[model samples]
Target: MTDWAAFTGFTGLVLVVLLSFAYVSRGVPHGDGASVSFDDNPDRETSLDGSRNDVELDGDELVSAATTENVVDGVSSTPIVPTPDSAAVSSDLPTHLLIANVAVSQALLGAFLALGAWYAEIPSAALGISAGDVPTKLGVGLALGLGLYAANRVGSSLSRQFGFTPDEALRESLTPESRAGWVLLLFVALPLIAGFEELLFRGALVGAVAVGFDVSPWLMAAVSSAAFGAGHSAQGRLGIVVTGLLGFVLAAAFVLTQSLLVVVVAHYLVNALEFVGNELFGW
Candidate 1:
């Protein structure tokens, strides 16, 4: 068993999982609906206490119920404009089912990679398992993750501005709408995705391959980063480019620090914050 063997096995596993995911996602509906926003929320109302659900006075008594539309002083303030006719939101896809599928696939692939690496007897350091400046790595990773997330938002906006409105169909389709589903996303799905992707792309693809082949880590970073971007084809063409650039940055970080932990933390925060921001602020 050698580092090359581990890398080869890992790439094979990744190809299998990615191909399977692409095949399985063929039926996912494209998002014809525009991004949901606060202005679209019909239930919001302005009152003496500020904003909240609609409050109305009837016979000297205030009545309150879940609002169907915004109303004030015998007038309908917000019309319930319907969602787009072609919107995927009309479909009955379950977010939990999507999350479960992703979690299981990543978990299986990660487990296999781990087993292969262990059998290959790859040095722990080569695999980025050493306890190197734990606090600094964590801190920098967190900051990097936050910065990347902000940059991601800006990049997406710029893409849209340039007549390349990103097809967020895949993201919208997988978005969880319930508390329980959100819990699963933040705690289970996100961490696994970040960890497994960082392990495969940065650790094995860049680190191990570079070390074993006596190749420049930067070269491996480009190769691995390209694959990383292709792995996210579900996000559409623009998404592929954006994700690839982001992947290159992560790969470079791995090459520089030689610590997968930093990239993992950064990746996790980027994804976690993306979901949280979308769910809360509809960003």
Candidate 2:
């Protein structure tokens, strides 16, 4: 018999490495760098009249000042503020690339896992990949997704009240400027993310470990959920904790219903609601 646990574990590792490379290559900075700040300099500042006097540096000290029209080295002395078109292009490029990379990678990974399951001779039903009651599953998923969203809102409020700053990376990713980008995120990337993660964690990892080790399903769920949380380490401590708890709930739902569709829908709804809330209400 093949060591299914090892196979699934290796697959998960590869996915993480690929995703991390994509993120880093796109210069998607995490933590403090995710947000734009304008508080570095207090002495060299703009005036209240929306204009600035350019200062000439002499041995690292300001020696003289001139108006915006003053020329320096045969070039215009005015500060070049980015045009709206230029700014949009610069911002949209990274966001588009990141979303595309995630969506494509996840779709491919989900397909690969399905093929692996077939090759391993695992029954589809055993892996919770079979179709069940569609309407009921969707309803349950929507309800659970809303519940999680509400809980997350409350948690965020409490965190703010306690002086904990929110995750800037998350906030940036959810707020897209272009309508096309937002549509792709909601319809393409979110589903791919949900499908791939659920298939990997709840389906492949849990199923393989349960069969290979002859362990209880719940134990496998817990172990796989932990791995799921670890995969989200880029989101920081609170993100990992909240994602872990959500993964646990998803695992339990899988165990109860034996339907991958249910969990995928639930996960997608959760992400969708998060983006919508963030965009509409600044949640």
Candidate 3:
């Protein structure tokens, strides 16, 4: 009775447009430079006590001085210097705004999924949301998460060796510039991202397609994983491929455990670890 094909198509189209917009906006240069550069100008030098004595200006344009330490909250802070050509606009979104956006998006997704499940007459268990063996599901999910992370690392290393650059969009969005950014990433962004993605791709999309078409679960997994990868177009070609493969693994886990909790935990761990490694260790 459910028009699963139409539903899947519409969802895929919406995701594609949103991802494309995110990618294109990041690609557009915010100012007049492709990159930022810092240079030394003797006239703008700091004193021996790490204090600037002169405020340098060029044609009414304020020049950001070289790195200076500023104490904030009783800790030494690295002054964010503007680029030689253009001022550095803070890429970090306000914490409250970011959290509110994520919360609203997740709430909308939850509502959509609920409606879809009802329309399809699909049992909650079939969508991997019903209560199950919690301990076993968590264990399997954690193991899969670790394995996926290792695979991603190896793949990334290989890509770098082949002259692959990191995705600018992802870097801009995920890399935190302040303590507040880190808190939002860890506490808000990561969980909502993981939960909503797994629910949509693995739980809703795969389940509906499989039920509506009477196709094998593997086939539905393939379809949904492709959409998942497509949603990451900002990450470039190799990123899409790698993400697609990883999506399949998550889908497989969802199928095996028949528990959304397992896949959500695994997805959360993977994203959290990636952000932490990138932020703390520059990996």
How are the candidates ranked when ordered by lDDT, highest leading?
1, 2, 3
Where does the lowest 10-residue lDDT sum fall in candidate 1? 75-84
Arranged by TM-score with the best first, the candidates are: 1, 2, 3
After aligning candidate 1 to the native by TM-score, how far in Å is the CA of 3 from where it should be? Answer: 5.2
Across residues 152-244, which tens digit of lDDT does each residue of candidate 1 receive? 777656655554444545555556778899888789978888888888888988888778778899998998888876666545444555677
Q: Candidate 3, 53: how far from true, in Å?
A: 28
lDDT of 1: 0.65
- Local distance difference test values of all predictions, in order: 0.65, 0.60, 0.57
Candidate that would win on lDDT: 1
* Residue-level lDDT tens digits of model 3 in 54-155: 555654353332211111111101110001100111233443454445545555655665665676566676578876688888898898888877776666
Return the top candidate by TM-score.
Answer: 1
- Alpha-carbon RMSD, candidate 3: 10.8
Candidate 2 per-residue C-alpha lDDT over 1-283 given as tens digits, one digit per residue, 9 for 90 to 100: 4646556666666556534533343222233222122445523433211234544455435422222112111111111000112122224446666566567767776777677666666666666775668888888878877776677677767766755555544436434568888888888888888887887788776655566667788998888777665565445444555667778988999888877888888888877777777679777
